[model samples]
Target: MEQESFRERRQAQAMGIDLPLGNSPADIRRRMEAIEFLLERSIQIPGTKYAIGLDAVIGLLPVVGDLIAAAMGSFIIWEAKRLGLPRWKLWRMVGNIALDTTLGAVPLAGDAFDLLFRSNSRNLRIVKRHLDKHHPETQIIEG
Candidate 1:
């Protein structure tokens, strides 16, 4: 059963379909956290305390790169909307994506900005805050 489920998820992803993380708030939170981690903090800078993920690395491809990153970032907002986040909060998340994409398009300077401004991480914070306050049971004790 588990293997079948995994295969289905892989197939869906291959075909550009997005499966729901799960039906529960906890499941959604976990999925969003994983996405955020992948997009913003999956890689370390070898010798420095700084870290970056696919967002920064892929943002080096000029226009196409920024668009791809923006699409990935938008997934977080979509999840937040699914969770019924307030309209204003959802708008704020959209603004983050816009700013990140706009400034991240600026050649050398935009690439530098991607390293410092992690929009996905910011959106994850908003999602987490909502989960922690409203669905306290979804909270994970990070050590």
Candidate 2:
């Protein structure tokens, strides 16, 4: 069963498809966590405790960078919607993305803000809270 699922997932990837059929709560949690990592904490600065991800790195490219970051951030909201999150929660997530994109568009200050704000991580937290309450089975016990 696992092999078949893996094969189907691979086939979907090969065809540039992202099927929603396989999006169980656990799957959504994993996807959201991976995205949060990529956008907010994928890299650690050498010899320092600070970390940054593609969101911060790409957000250095002026207008285009902020736009790309906003788009990536939108994916988290998309996944949350899949879980039937409340409208208010979705709006809150959208607001975070808007704030990040708007403020992060302000040249140097924006880049600095992107590094600190971590909107994706915020969205992930919101999703995690909802999932924990409504989908406890998806909770992963990290040791």
Candidate 3:
């Protein structure tokens, strides 16, 4: 019976409809890590100790850059919500995205802020903490 249930859950997830309580911790952790990688440290700065990703590059556009970045950041929050995070944490994530978007709207400063702030990475950390506290069994240890 348990095996059948697990199979059903997996099928649901495969169809892109993640069950609220059916996702394994490992799956969640993996998804969050992927998001962090895409949003934060996908590329290394030459001759510098900094890394960035699409978030920074997209934020380089004049007017629409910040908006695109914020939209991408929203995906992290959406995943957190799907994980059943509390309202407070969800709002905090939104606030982080909002701040990132607002400050990132500046001409040159916003682009720099996108590199420094890394709102998607910040949101990923929040999701990790919530998972660690609430679903420790799903935590994946990285070497």
The weakest ten consecutive residues by lDDT in model 1 span: 12-21
What total of clashing residue pairs does each candidate reach?
Answer: 0, 0, 0
lDDT of each: 0.89, 0.90, 0.81
Cα RMSD (angstroms) for every candidate in the order listed: 4.2, 4.7, 6.4
Estimate TM-scores for all models.
Answer: 0.87, 0.86, 0.80
**For model 2, which pairs clash?**
none
Model 3, global lDDT? 0.81
Candidate 1, residues 21-111, lDDT tens digits: the string is 4769987887787778778987889999988998999999997899999999898999899999999999999999999999999999999
Give per-residue lDDT, candidate 3, residue 16: 48
lDDT of 2 by residue, 1-143 (tens): 88887887787667544433457999888878877887898788999999899999999999899999899889999999999999999999999999999999999999999988989999999999999999999999989
**Quick one: best lDDT, which candidate?**
2
Q: Tell how far residue 25 is off in model 1, in angstroms.
A: 0.5
Off by over 4 Å in 2: 1-21
State the local distance difference test value for candidate 1: 0.89
Tens digit of lDDT per residue, candidate 3, span 1-143?
98887897798567544443335766766766666677788788999988888889888897698898788779888878888999999999999999999998999988888888978888888998999899888876779
Off by over 4 Å in 3: 1-22
